[model samples]
Structure formats: C-alpha cells, structure tokens
Target chain A: MDMSQYYGLFISEAREHVRKIGESAVQLEADPTDRPTIDALFRSAHSLKGMAASMSFTAIADLAHKMEDLMARIRNGLPVDSSLFDLLLAGADRIGAMIDDLESGGSGRGDSAALIARMLAYSPGEQPAPPDREVVETSPPSLVPPGEPVGTTAGEEWGVPKTVRVKTDTLDSFVTTTGELITVKHRLALLAGSCREGGLHEALRDLGRHLRALHDQVMAVRLLPLSAIAERLPRMVRDLSRQLGKEVSFTMQGVDMELDRSILDLLGEPLVHILRNCIDHGIEPPPARGAAGKPAVGRLSLSVARRKDQVEIEIADDGRGMDPGAICAAAVARGVISGEKAAGLTSHEKLMLVCQPGFSTAPAVTDVSGRGVGMDVVKHTLQSLGGSLAIRSEPGRGSTFLLKVPVTIAIINVLLVVVGGMTVAVPLTAVIRTLEIRRDERGNVDGEEIFFLDGEELPLLTLGGLLNIPGGDGPGDTLAVFVAEIGGRRVGIQVDRLLGHQEVFVKPLGRPLSALPGLNGAAILGDGQIVFILDIVHAG
Target chain B: MMFRLRERRFALEVDAVAEISELLPEYPIPGAPPFLRGVVNMHGRVAAVLDLGAFLGLGTAGRGGSLVLLESPGCSLALLVEHLERMITSDDVGATRRGESRLLPVELVLADGMAGLLDVAALMDAVEKSA
Candidate 1:
C-alpha cells in the first residue's frame, strides 16, 4: 500500500497507542480488577492493530491482534499475573522497536510470530485463532495514556495550535533572542530616561509593553507541566520496588505543576537518584516495617508546589530515617570535618553532609541501579538551576528532600544589589522580604551577624564578605537586609546598596565560569552594565 | 572576520561572527579563572566574555575594547578583542595549513602581521575542557 502521506499521522498515533498499553498495563498490574483500565488496555491494543493494518504494517498488526485478544480475556475477569506483565512489557518493547525501524525508512516488520504464539499460549478460555485479522482500517485510536485525550479527530479540526512538536533547541533559540531583545529594550529605556524626551519616553514605554508580552509568551512556551517528566514514576516505582523485594505505595501531588523544560530535564536525574535511594536505603523492608509496628507497605510521596516564581519539590519516604549521630561519626571518620566541628554542626547541617560530594553511609546500588553516586549530584544539579536542596529526617520516621527551584531559568525578576563595587542580581522570588534594618535590630551570634526578622532570629551574611570582595561601602549602622529562602532555611543578605528590581534574561555562565560558586550568570542593565546574578539558593 | 587581542590577531569565519559591540560594563565573577573576564550582557542575553590572552597563557592584557560575539549550535562566547581591526574576506587572507595537525591550523597572513585562524569546533572542545 502506498501510504506515504499518512506516515506522520500513523507514526504519532501508533506510538501514543503503544504508550497507552504500556502505561495501562502498569495500572492494571497495580489493581488487577480495575475494569475500566482493563477495557482501556484492550481498546488501545485493538487500536494499534487497526492502525497497523491500515498502514499495511503486517508485523505490528499481528502482534497487536494477539495483545488485543489477551487483554480482552483479562478484561473478562481472568486472573492476571506478573508473568503477564513481563510478557506484555516485552511485547510493547518489540513493537516500539518496529515502529522506530519503520520511521527510519526500514520495513515496519519484526519477528512477532514467537510473541504472538506466546500470548496465545497464555490466553485463558482461548477462542479459536481467527483466520483473518482486520486490515485496511483507519479509525483513530480510542484510548490515550491517562490524563490525555486522543480518541476522536475533533482535536485536529480546530485551527489553534493543538500540539507543537518543536525541537527543544528551537525553543531555546527563541528564548535567547527574546532575552536579547529585552536587553535592547533596557538600553532604549535608558536612552529615553537620559534625554527625557516625551515622544521617546512614550515610544520606549510601548516597546517595553511589547517586550514584556513577548517575554511572557516565550517563557510560557518554555514552561512544561511537571507531568511531562513525571508520567512514568508510578510504573518505575512499581517495577523498581518489586525488583528490590520491597513493598512501596508511591503517591505524587501537584503533578501538573510546570517548570522550564531545561530545568525539568536536568531534574529527572536528581529525582531518580533520590527515588532509588529511598527504595534502597531509606525505605525499610516489609519485615522491618512490620517489626516496627508500621504498615507493611512503605510510603514514598512527592509533592510539588509553586511558591511565587519558584517551585518547591518534596520527595518524602516513610522508611528508615537517617541517624544524625551516625552521620557525624562518619563525617569525622572520613575526615570530612573535625570532631569539634561535627559536634557544633546543627541537625540540618548534619543531614546536608549526606550530600557532600564524597559523603555516603549506605553502600552504593552497584547491582540493579548501577548508581554509585549519592545526594551530592542532586545538590549540585539543584545549585545549577539556581535552586537549593535540603534534607529533613527523623531517626525513627523517614527522610524528605526539599528542592526549591526557580520555575524559569531563561528570564528572571531580580533585586540587583551592589556589593564591594560589583553589582549582583538576586532572584526576587527567592527574596521573602526586604527590610531596612536599624542598628537595634542587628546583633551578633558567634561573631557572625544576626537579625531578628518576623519574630525569628536568623543568620545574616554580608554579600561582600561571602564573595570575598573587599572594600564595599562597608556595612552601615542602618542596612538594607534582604531575606531570601534557601534550602528550607531563611538567610538575611545585607548588601551595600539596593539597586532595586528588574526583569532580565539570564544566560549560562558557560562551562568553567559556571563552576564559580554562587553566581549563576550575568544580566545587563539598561546602561549596558553587566551584573552577575547570584545563586542565592546556594549562597543562602 | 578578524580581531586582535593585545598584539596577537585571531581570525574566525564571517558566518561565525554574530555581532560586535564596544565593551560593556563587566561584573567580575569572583571565583572564575583569569581567562574568563566575568560576563557581559549582550542585549538581554548574558554571555561569558573570554579573555583569549588568559586562555592562551598570554596573560589578560586589555580589558576595555570590543567584544566579538561567536556562537555555534550549543555553545556561545564573546571573544574580548583589543580592537575591531578590520574585516577581510577568506580569499584575501593568505591561509596556511600547519601540516603536522589533522585539525585546521590556518594562519591568515595580514598586511602587517600574521593572525592564527582557529577551528571553531576545536575551540569549543577547548572551552569544554576548560570547564
């Protein structure tokens, strides 16, 4: 069949159906008696068969035909087993490879006869093998992966951009260019301000409006709902926990929270690391849980919430919580810290030690996950995103890793501060409150500055002192204190001058430069003055 | 396209050149190595301005001058130059191959002096290695 024109439609729709079956299979495994999910899985398999038949992709159609038959019986209340999941997953993998082969201009064919026979062998109340599989069928796939719809053709009918398949790099460039334009607008604003020409001022104002709108649209394009990166967690948790011989009930909140695609992509690894750690180190085995008078099934939950422009992600595992005393001892033995220093360390600081690059108490997952790395990578990744990660654990309870991250990395609203003759941009969203501190409000604790903010005493650091930049209009009796949240703690950053706020585009500090401790990148002011954007997440 | 850093001259293909702007106010990044001369806002985009002299071990000589913005698919850098000397077509610049190296080692022989032409890909590798 000459089906050249329909390849794109067929490939996309077929892949969606393939995904539907895999995800539904996991759901059905979780609740074997879920009638709707079973029906949906069968429908997806059937849709795949019909689509493949229409494209004359006999190999795909044949495998789907058997899968559909198997699911249909399972839908009819037959007992399902893990072996069934294994077989279905294997079938889905093979079908995926076949479609990929076809997309790359090869015949959409694979040896599915073995797979077909295996499904037939496992089928309960086996009906006689049908003589003829349906062919030349073009009805759209009836089922979509849960939370998304792809049943009818009506979505394509609308003129609006239903779904755009833009390469990430394309969106990146668009964002970059928009950032450049915003910088230009700043320059124009400066020009207008200096000249004080009425016409130019109005023109500049109009330009600012346009640029702001453009920036919003560009940023919106970059923001992807968390579900894009999170959809497979349930399946992963189920598979990994089962493989580890542990019982876990995984739950997620705010799955629809959105973040920049770039940030979200980098986030996946850190999350995977934490989740694996939860199963291997944090979560107690079923016997241990029962011994502790706890539920046999371990509970691991992820909650994501947007706090202004920043998103906070919390991964909590109700398993074996960390022992701070043991951590301190380990740190001391590893020469990570002195015995005296370890004794002085706060509970939070001791927990943070687990994320120190070479710090690990639990043996690495050298077998299944093949990940020998620890929480340090997670901390580093968060730092790079102008974010911070903190861990909270109770000895007999569990551990929760909190990550506070900026929602968008491309553009930011910052409170620019000048310290030691250098201008630095602090993300405004990170700033909880800015205050004018009177001399009475400032005090010293352990020779370090402290401030009473909102009825709480918090440690304060001079921006200049932190950067080791000398000779800033040194701290005055009355100071401007910026309270920023980092790593689940509050810090007061006292700066020499408050340069007010701005919405600026940020670029990567790039490679070696990016390695610099607390600076994310640079932002240009209206007068073309470059200011380093501070990584308050790390600094605080 | 050609520009000079201190007394040394470097040449990049015209297409590699994104824009040229007079020195912008640079905020010194405290912990960065000497080769990286902080960052400058090129329009709204923040870019790391490289002191080629420092990278080549020539020592960071000039700070106030022009920036030659260069970008590839995944990388972008602002080459800090002492001056925007002049633009010469690839044909006009007498090029030479350093026979020993597989990578391009073209030197553009200008009227007054010779400017070493760099392979953008290799330069990117150098930057990545620098990280």
Candidate 2:
C-alpha cells in the first residue's frame, strides 16, 4: 500500500506525541511515583508505536515498543530509578532524530539496538515474555487504549474552539479563498461609492462588514496556541540543564496565546537556538549561583502576549546577565567594531553586539550552544517574518531576548509609493520615515547620489532608476524620500509621490518569481490594483 | 493561440493560454528586469505583466493594450501585448523546421506571415533567467 499520502498525518501526529512524551518523561523524572504521568507516558508511547507500525516505519515502531514496555514496568511498582529516566529520554531523542530524518525524505529508522537493550535492562524480572513485536495493522485502530472511551472526561478543559486535524492544503485553500474575497470586498467598496444610499449600497456595506469578520475567522482557523511549541520546551531546558549541571526550572506564562502555525513552525529553530543558549551560556552553574548569593536553581521564563498587531514573545533568564565589557572586548577582537566605538557603546548596545555576525563571547565552541553563530541567525529569522529582535540585559542580573512578530502574514501594513506613476507597496514595519527631498538636500558627491538627512548623509537611488523605468532627474527640485531601515542599514528611496499608507494582502511569490531580487511578493490594492511589495533588505 | 506585439504576430499553443483579457491596471516594480513591466490584477490574483517583445529582446515601442495570461506549476505571469489576434486553425498553419531561438523554439504558424508558434514551457525558463 502506498503510505506516502499518510506520511504528512503520521509525521505531524507522531511529532505531537513525541513532544508530549518528552514533556511527560521530564515530569516523571521529577516525581517517579506519579502514576498519572507514568500512565500518560505509557499511553503516548503506545500510540506512537501503533502509528509508526501503521506507517511501516519499523525502527521508530520498535523503539517506541521498547519504550512502552519500559514504562509498563515502572507502572507495575518497579523500583523508581534515575537510570530509567535516562533510558526513556534517550529513546525519545532517538525517535525524535528519526522523525527529523524521515521528514527530510529518509526512512524514519536508526540503529536503536543499543537503546532498546538499555531500556529492556530496566524492566523488572519475573515478567512474562514480552508480546511478539506486533506490526500494527489498522482497519480502524483506536488511538486511545482499548478500554478508554472517546468522549472527554470530566477533568478536561472546555469552552475552547473544538478543532479537528485538517490537511494543510485544505487550510491553505481556505485562506486563499478568503484573500480573494478580501479583494472582492475592496472592489465592492469602490462600487458602493456612486450610489450613496440605497438598499444595494447598505447590502454591500453589510457584506463588507461580514466579509471582514469572515476573513478573520478563516485566518484564525490556521492559528495554533504558542504553547504547542512552548510546551515542548520544558523538556529541552530540562535536558540542557542536566547536561550543563545547572539546577534550572523553566516557567512559562501566557501559553494560551496563539499565532499562525506557519509562523510558529518557522519560529522553531530560532526559539530552540535562543533557549539552548540561555541554558548553556546565560544560566550559571549551581555552585556559582550559590556563590553569587542567588538561588541555586536558575529560572528561565518564556512569556507570550498580543500587543496590538504584533505578538511579543519574551525569553528571560535569571542567571548571570551578560557582561558588556566582555562583549565589547569580544566585538573588538573580532573586528566587528572598533575598540574606541565599543568603549562608547551603551550597556544595551554592548549586549546587542553579540548579535553581530561573527561576534561571540563563548569561551570555546561546544556541541550545545555557544558555537559563535548565535544571535545573528536569531535576528535574521525574526526579521524575515516582518519581526524584530531586541535584547535587554543587566550585568549582575540576567538577559532577555524580546521577539516581536506580526500577528498574521495575510495582511500587512504598507506605505504605498508612486514611482514614475507606478505604485509599489513597502511594508511599513521596515519603513523608518518618509521625507520630502528638496534640491539642496540631495546632490551627487563623488558620483554617488547622497541625501543629507538629519546630520548624516545616506546613499540615495531613485525608485524609477532602480527599476529602469525611465524617469527621475539627478538633481531633484522636489522629491519624496522613503528612508527604510533594512538589516540595520539605512536606505533612502527617492520616489515621485507618496500614495499614503494602507493595510494590504501580500501574496507569496512562489519559487520562480520569489527568486527574482527586490520583490518580496505582490499585494492587491483597494481599487483592484496589484502592486509588488519590495523585499527591502534584498533590494539594494 | 494568436497574439501580437506591435506589428509582429506570434502563436501560442492552445494549452499555454490561461485566459485573455483587456489590459488591467498594473503597478510597476522597481529593481526588476527591463522586460518585467509591472504587475496586474488577474481576477483576484496578482500576475507579473511583462512586455513579451522587450523580454525576447524585440522592442514593442512601449505599449500594452491586452494581456495573455500564462501559467505553469508554481508560477504565473502575463504577456502584455498590443492586442489579441483572431484564432488561427492548425490547418491554416505552415510548419517550418527553420532554426528558431534555442530557448523558445517556434514553428511558423501561418503560411503567408512570419507568425511563429511559441513554446511556453521553454519561454518560462527564458523569462526566469532574464528575471
């Protein structure tokens, strides 16, 4: 049977179960005798095995089979031990790695004999021979245990929107339809103009209102709680804390806040990178924490909240904060910044220097965190999604990485610009300010068009000249200058007119078109007009 | 299957045509290649409206009266042409083996004119490279 079609469902569900199992395993370590946690862990592992077996991914199924057996022994009053903890975690890690392999089109298999043997070693004696590794066959196999019923029990939470698993394609198509409806709404708004008051006008106005809400509902259908990813983090921090010999506890608040799954998925690597760095570098060792007059247990908090059109995720640590002097010194040594400039940097500026590519204060490179390429990647990832990263630190306290991400990618606020009678959409997030250019303010100095703005001169290029549209004279009598900050560099775009600002739907310029430079994607205006949104960072 | 760029005529395989429509309002994109004139709204979708003449290095004297929309898997763009010509039957066409642009080989689709058949798939690659 062709299992390719089922791969997407299998992978997503398997990953969820893996993350859930990891969280349960971490909890089991804290309280080995917690029956509920043990039961949950066993149930999750068994489900994973069944799912894997159904997919014919033997290695993952086999490992999960062993893990289920191990958890069963623990449930049967076996002596609680730390070795079991390591075995269960190792099993999880192997399965996790295999899933990663399979996701990139490899068989979800790995050499798990050693891990299986170790887990089997933890099983208590006096047990009957384990059931034959049954390759699961599903006519309609139940995910829950045989005796468990379908309905939610009394303890389960309620009042939340009931959600069902949908193929991503279905959701994408729904979003696309809603986007088209948005354009139609704009078209109707323009049509509703001529006749000020009539049944048709009122009807169109009502339709517009309802369509706006409908668009929101459709977009919200793709949103997932930030906790889906955040919940997986306690396990990561637990493992990292152990590896580093640091007594740390990860506490999260506002886990119920949600965002588009697309953003959350893209956020995975950068979040993990930051969280790992926090444990491996930011948090101090237990003895050091005690010596420094702080609690032996380190605390890292990840909080998410909605702020206007953006969602702010703050990852904070209570370990030894960043040392500005050390950072400045590192920046100097790496030639990222001059020693004199480093000396003049504020504490915040010095802390931010770590985000500069090639600037790292890590004593040496290690497998876990501190590999030199750190904040720069984090900053770049966030920036690509119309997001920004900010760092705050106190030398003796701790550091916090603040990630501000747009709420939705469907609609973006933009500044509409008219260049030689052609309109272009510029994301407002990247736009610093727009100024009118007078003849005296801009001139050619050393063969470069320079716009003198606020005591500093910046290289300026006409928007028309950039596109080779055949307009815009060198020394302008009057012009509109759009100063946008891209990757921390200022770029002045000279255009003929400013067509005001708007919130517009930006479409992804799939493969062929996206590869073309300067254009991020395209957007449809209120008047059935299409404009290209500048990928400002890539424009120059 | 028939299109015009200035006075020159071209033929597109019937399969290459997605839709033919009057020229829609287009917004110019700065920093794009010369032939990528601008973008236009196609129904509710945004399509790159390019001057096929300029793209093929044949000047159109800078005019666009109609658009011939084309689509390939994962990509869609429009050829901004002067206007659409009357449909041509295959029986009225004369096939020539004479050399054509390697990127987009053409078959003379008309017996009495220089109108040549356009290979859209190959032209997509050509446009991608130029873009």
lDDT score for candidate 1 against the true structure: 0.77
Determine which window of 10 residues in candidate 2 chain B has minimal summed lDDT. B97-106
Error of 2 at A503 (Å): 5.2
Write one digit per residue (lDDT tens) for candidate 2, span A1-540.
Answer: 576877777778788778888888888887878999998988778788878877778899888887887777777667776777778878888998999999999977789987776666564343433345322222222344221222234587755446567777898888777777777777777877887578878788788788778878877888888887888888888878888898888888897888888788888788889989888888999889889999999989999889877799999998788988888887898899988888777776787888888877778887897674478888766766767787888876998998888777876678988776678888887778998878777779889888888889888977776666665653457778889754445778888788789767779875346657577678887677778887665454
Model 1, position A419: C-alpha lDDT score: 75
* Predicted candidate 1 versus true structure: per-residue lDDT over A1-540, tens digit per residue: 356876877788788787777777887777888888887877778778777876778889888877877776676556787767877877887899999999999998988887776676673345534434322223333333322333334344634456757667899999989988888888787767769568888888898899899888988988888877676677778778888889999888998999999999999888878888888888888999999988999999999998877899999999999998899899899988889988988898888988886787866535543455568888888888888888899987999988888889988889988777777898887788888888787889889878887799998888777776763435577887788865567888888888799988886765446656887777776778877788777762
The residue pairs found clashing in candidate 2 are A467-B31
**DockQ per candidate, 2 decimals:** 0.40, 0.37
Quote the chain B TM-score of every prediction. Answer: 0.84, 0.87
Best by lDDT: 1
All predictions: root-mean-square deviation over Cα?
5.1, 7.6
